[model samples]
Each structure stands twice: as structure tokens, then as C-alpha cells.
Target: MSSFTYHSLPGFGEQCCEEYGFSDACIIGDRIIVTGQTGMNPITLQTSADIGEQVAQAFENINNLIVHALGKEGHPAHHEGKSGWEHVVKLHAYFVGLSSIRDQARALMVRSIKQWCPNHQPLFTMVGIESLPFPEHHVELEVFVQARMVRFVTNESAS
Candidate 1:
């Protein structure tokens, strides 16, 4: 029944979500879900045309969101493993031109995953799409996080 409010990125506000009716990130207990992220820069609010860089930036954006959700509020801190990137347990990747760029995309994703989780690999599903919501965005990543959920129960409740 307990849930954390959505943590939206910059440039996305009430109007944007009201139109789309979606939030960038939401957390329920320990589980977190982040909307597909593009290579948009949080500061500049721009997406790179380069696919490789776009993939990297998209992952970076996911990392930023994880840190915001897992770490202490108002303070920058690394998550349990690999600076908050490990919290990302699963990913759904969308590519604009899959047939032409599958190899490049796979390579970059593998390299990035290694850097994030050296000991384990998160399950990934890559999909080819004609286009993305944002025209300039070449790659979009949907992130899912599952952490240990703990609830405090008083003696009365336990009894």
C-alpha cells in the first residue's frame, strides 16, 4: 500500500506528463521503474544524434535516476554496487535502425554493462523500431529495478 511518488527528470513537468500521462520514474517499496530514457542531457535537455553516444547517455540518465531513488534524499551517494548502476536489474532497449546497427548497439551495451556489473549481467531485450518518440533519439532504454523490500512490523502486528 506504501509507494513513493514519481521522480521526474528536468524539462518534464505537469504539462508534459498530463499530456502523455506518464512519469519518468516511480518507486513502490524497493522496486523502481524508469521510463525509457534517451540520450537527452539532463542539463542541456538535448539528445545526441550519434547512436553510440546516445546509448551511453541514455544509460547515464538511468544511472542518475537510480541514484536519486536509492540514495539519500538531497545527497549524492553511490548505490549498493557499481555506483548505482547495478540497481538496474533489467533493461529493454529500443533501436531506431536495428538491422543496420545491431552489432554496434550490442557492442556498446555489452561494454557498458561490463562497466556497470562486472560480476553479473542484467537481462536485456533489444527491439527494433521504425522510430522513437523523439526523432533525434536513436536509442531508448526502459529500466527496471528490484531490490530487497523490508517492512518494520511491531510486536502487536507480529502477534
Candidate 2:
């Protein structure tokens, strides 16, 4: 049959599911392909002007997606060994005015990645963009993760 299975976490990417019919992430076999995440708060829908804040929020958003995809709670520090961000294998970050904030974004991203994936380094890509879906958003991050093990919920009702 088909390997693709799509999901949208409760508050994170539900709008896209309800309005646009796009899921936050898709699971194909052991891999989770997540949509690009912005700094905009899912509850407030507001994005911070500070690039650091935006970058931090974006990473948090990505982590939340990964956590939900793995069918686990969002807390407790870490999941069963090699879960959450630890499963991430690739990351692509899009930044507006990358030249202006390259150093700051680099430092922040590097620190976060090192903290999250201390044992392995995921392939990373950073590119410049003129604008994002929202004006206030300064950076967007998308991740590709390989789950060491996953319990797939075949239907939304089951999830």
C-alpha cells in the first residue's frame, strides 16, 4: 500500500489541516518529514522581532512536531533513548537577511543542535530568503528525522 501517513499536532499545525488540508508532518516508513516551522507562536500567532527569539521558537516548534509524531508526551526532558531531536537527520533553515544575522543565527543554531543532538550531527543547510509567509518571521526551520522506532497510528481517530 502507501507508506505516507500525515498528522497535525493539536495546536501546532492544526490550522493548516483544517483550512489548507496540509499536515504538519508526514511519516514514510521510519522517516518523518516536517513542514517548515516559523517563530510564530501557535497560541498567540505572533512572531517576535528578535532573530534569536524567532530561531529559538522555531526549534521548539520543530521539537514539538517530532515529539508528537513519536506518540509521546512533550515533557520529561527526553524520550526513550534516541527520540525527539535526537532522531533528526537533516535540517534546513531559511533566514531573511542571512548576511546581516548569519553570525547570531549560526551561534544559536549551533548551540541548540549541539545540546539536542550531542552524539550525532545532522546534515544542515542555511539559505537566504526575501520573505516568509509572515512578515514578522525572520527564520523558518524544517527537519527530516529518522525514528529509531515508531508506533504508527493509522487513523486520526486512533491518534
Number of the top-ranking candidate, with TM-score as the measure = 2
Q: Tens digit of lDDT per residue, candidate 2, span 1-159?
A: 647878777775888799887998887766789999999887678788888888888888888778887674232333564447888889999999898888988898898888778877889999988999778888999999887634466688496
Clashing pairs in 1: none
List the candidate 2 regions with Cα displacement exceeding 4 Å: 72-83, 149-159
Please provide TM-scores, in order, for all candidate models, with all chains considered together: 0.79, 0.83
Worst 10 residues of 1 by lDDT: 72-81
Q: lDDT (0-100) at residue 21 of candidate 2?
A: 79
Of candidate 2, the 10-residue stretch with the lowest lDDT total is 72-81
Q: What is the lDDT of candidate 2?
A: 0.81
Q: What lDDT tens digits, residue by residue, belong to model 1 across residues 51-121?
A: 88898888888887777656533322343444556666788999988999989989988888887767557
